[model samples]
Target: MKKTESISFQDFMNESYKKVKRRSRPYRTFSFVPFSPFAMLDPTILTIGGIVLGVVLIERFLERLGVLDIVDKISSVMRFLFPLTFFGAIIYFLVTF
Candidate 1:
């Protein structure tokens, strides 16, 4: 008498495992930190760098909106409210967390 071929649990799992791997092979490194203090410098340097970056970003945004020349006027007004914004953020974080 001839013996019939049998499918074991291990064989079934191996085939399914290969299909899962193939399907998920496209997504590799998901979490990424492009900018971090550890990669760059001390607090003082970071603070100054952040200020410069902020100025550049604001300038770019204003230029895009054709308001680049109004930055100085905007800054004078925004300087006062900057503290309020910080205080509000702190209060929000404390209340939520």
Candidate 2:
């Protein structure tokens, strides 16, 4: 009888493994100091995070008052009418110029 399934062979089985060969990093020899004390130095990330937080809080507040759906409807209508208004403004600009 022949074996239907055979065990897999590993690539490292032919080579001897090194016990300690991975401590060549530059930080091992040099002292490292961060330029900024804070983890994140850029304030733009904080500003954007604040805007996102504000939007989420306001959306939740509107949803709790049952006004989020109404706001969505108004936004959709405004989106649909945006192109027409944009074209009207372009035409007015061209005529007045």
Candidate 3:
């Protein structure tokens, strides 16, 4: 049986760099699509936008989960605030009456 050895990281990096160098050379002409000035026309831009949107969505999900986790804490803290709120309401009622 014959066994093959894996290429070293330096050799892999050299080949990858060569491929990137070839692809990165500029061509003679570049065509552009016409679109609304403010709108992004690149698919990569849309993908980036989608990623940002996903991050925001995940952040909101985490925020809601945190709020759910802290609901009992909120109620305990509101015990003190409620008295002040009630006092204000009673004073308002008396002044209005």
Number of the top-ranking candidate, with TM-score as the measure: 2
Regions more than 4 Å wrong, model 3: 1-39, 67-97
**Over 4 Å off, model 2:** 1-37, 70-97
In model 1, which regions exceed 4 Å deviation?
Answer: 1-56, 60-69
For 22-62, candidate 3 gives per-residue lDDT tens digits of: 35676687457434444444454556557556655655675
Question: Among all windows of ten consecutive residues in candidate 3, which has the lowest summed lDDT?
Answer: 33-42
* Model 2 alpha-carbon miss at residue 5, Å: 72
- In terms of lDDT, the best-performing candidate is 1
Could you give candidate 1's per-residue lDDT for residues 1-97 as a string of tens digits?
9987667789787775344333545655654654444543545445655765686588668868888568767677667856666576546544543
lDDT of 1 at 59: 64
lDDT over C-alpha atoms for residue 66 of model 1: 85
In angstroms, the error of model 2 at 23 is 23
Instruction: Quote each prediction's TM-score.
Output: 0.33, 0.34, 0.30
- Expressed as tens digits, the lDDT of each residue in 1-97 for candidate 2 is 9867433355246444333477765654444662344534346444545655665576667778989787686557656665665565446544543
State which candidate, 1 or 2, has the greater TM-score.
2
Backbone clashes, candidate 3: 0
Cα deviation of 48 in candidate 3 (Å)? 0.5
